[model samples]
Target: MKLTVTSSLLALALISSSADIGVHANTPFIIEKSPVDITLFVMSRCPDAIKCESTFSQVFQAEGLPEINPTLSYIGSIDETETSKTELDLSTTSTTTTTTVVTKVNCKHGPLECAGNTHQLCFREFFPDYKVWVPFVTTMNSWQPRRIGESAYAREVAERVLGLRQRRVRRFLSLEEEDAEEKKKELEVLLEKVDECSEGQRGFELLVKSVQNTLDHGVGTSCTVFIDNKKRCVVDGGVWRECPGGSTVADFVRSIKEAAGKVFRISW
Candidate 1:
């Protein structure tokens, strides 16, 4: 598929109202720290990607003021194939409880007649013990698809669907951990900034921008902040704002914090 790529600049503004209070280089806003060793893959053209990016940017811009440990490094241009492969591997292996059966049958009758034959005179089973194994195989096969699908969905939900929010929460928590006082102050400032940026903006345009910006620079696919080992998020551009069930950046962020808190024991 042809991907439409767009570029927008994220100005990490460290604006000071007065000259007496000079913005210090070591004050943390301007210095770009390595993000939390995470990698994110996103298409520049995708809406969900954009949403994820903006959320992280907002979070970083908000939390990255006074410096914090677990720096979030934002890498550019993810290899889609590699990301997909990694995701697939993670999905396939992260599952539990899989069963498979091997069956061996001996018959003197023709292969076509085996199905029609009901009497034991035409066929004999070499491994009578195999019958006991049949249930195990059947159970395994029955649950295999569910296990695989759940793992895949889990990864998708964690990485692609809920990634931006997770990264934001993680970064926020990291900031809190590194310096609670600093994080609190920065969060206040960030919230003010968000209020200002969102002022006079309303409705769908605001929603789109929120999602788009998040993906482009903040939390999702196109984010600059890295969280774990892989990109903490993914953008399903095809589904972005295409339905009412689609969530806003704020909503997603809230949900992410809640979910991550449950899973990773990190509070936002």
Candidate 2:
């Protein structure tokens, strides 16, 4: 029978899943007990920044961490004539558009105002769920970095909060195949599919290799499933590492559970 996965179940699965690395009583990262202030610097048009804000907001709401006061900043236009430039050779028939946008314009205080504006819009677009600490403004040249430093501290707190949220999501979405008979059948089918796919001359071999590597080196440690500086998904040692490139969400969830099973030892 097909089981329905709910958000609550998913959250629970994330929380209850055993980590390959044994859980220690001590926290690795220090999160201040009090609320932290944060400033996020972003570009209005950068998708990476937008994703970061969205993910962070999800995590923030998931974990009831202390109240955070965050400021979002955007980098504005820049003068191309006054700045150094690099040229790239392109094929005449290339269809790709190579448009360069200058973020820093002729502002006296540099592009701080532009940066703040861009960041503000990005936060609004991506993290509408979270309460915005900074309102939309044309510029913020007088913005202080010390505020941003505090905001960074708040961001650290948000990470831990998100972990708790992830746990809830996992639990809410856990599959109910506890019986040995059912589990064995599922495993056999999965194995058969793997074998069948491997025998074909498809490009799935590389993916299989990556899964195998993750099984070997990914357990009991914080593995980054996807990371692009600003955006990342890290699976803690005890948690399952979701497949980085799964064809479907279900496949991705299965991969994470499988990886966790191989690496973790469950404890109360």
Candidate 3:
């Protein structure tokens, strides 16, 4: 039997099937429903995204995943449009015609960012296990904003930076080309073969829409944390100058220190 994986569905259950996705394939990164749910929606290239990702790496490592369940994802998708063109040559006695595919893309930082965002989304949606997903995020963010173009460079980034092999990062940019339908099948197991990649689109869009779905935007910040429609915490402001409280990296660190001091006092 085949499983239909959806964000809503996956949040409810994790596919226990053995699938190799990350450097640490032994760890499971399943998203279990817990009292605390955190999602950080930001542009792929935004500095705030980096801050949020970095902060999560530090805090999660110190406090563990259970203390602060975080979902770091892009806030937009690549707009895909296809147009067919026929060109005729009437030079000789016989006429020859050719049809071509044209694709246009607009990403937050550029095409590189779109590619990076899609790869991250693919991992989160399909290959999310603690061993694979967590390491991928922490490592990729550490060396991210890579130069645009080529899956080979991405594979290199994975190997050298994340210590992942070739096949491990193969699907990272699997949905880059125009034929997303075919690529989705080759990339994700549960998806059906079709003319377009509805499943992939949904996965990408779900994260994109997460920004509007939460109170993060109200605070004018990228890595703001929200729980039950309430603003919890946020990294320093990125583009939005008015983003509240947090400003620089040190400000965030200071806030942590303050919180820890309060905890120490309470403990005493």
Give TM per candidate: 0.20, 0.23, 0.46
lDDT of candidate 3 over 71-121, digit per residue (tens): 654554334455655555667556554555443334557666665655555
Please state the error at residue 155 of candidate 2 in Å. 28
Model 1 Cα displacement at 131 (Å)?
61
Cα-based RMSD of candidate 2: 25.9
What is the full ranking by lDDT, best candidate first?
A: 3, 2, 1
Q: Residue 46, candidate 3: how far off, in angstroms?
A: 1.6
Off by over 4 Å in 1: 1-39, 43-51, 59-234, 237-246, 263-268
Highest lDDT: give the candidate number. Answer: 3
Give residue 263's error in model 3 in angstroms.
Answer: 20
Query: Deviation in angstroms for 77 in model 1?
Result: 12
TM-score ranking, high to low: 3, 2, 1
In candidate 2, stretches whose alpha carbon ends up further than 4 angstroms from where it belongs are 1-34, 76-268
- Candidate 2 lowest-lDDT run of ten: 133-142
Cα lDDT tens digits for candidate 2, 197-241: 333332122322333333443322222333211212433333333
User: Model 1's lDDT to the true fold?
Assistant: 0.31
Question: Model 1, range 1-268, lDDT digits (tens) per residue?
Answer: 1232222111222233333246443353432333232233332222333455444444433422322222222222221121112222465566444444433222122222121111111111111222222222122223332331122322222222212324454463554544755554554454344333323233123333333433465453333323333233344543443223234545434433433333332221
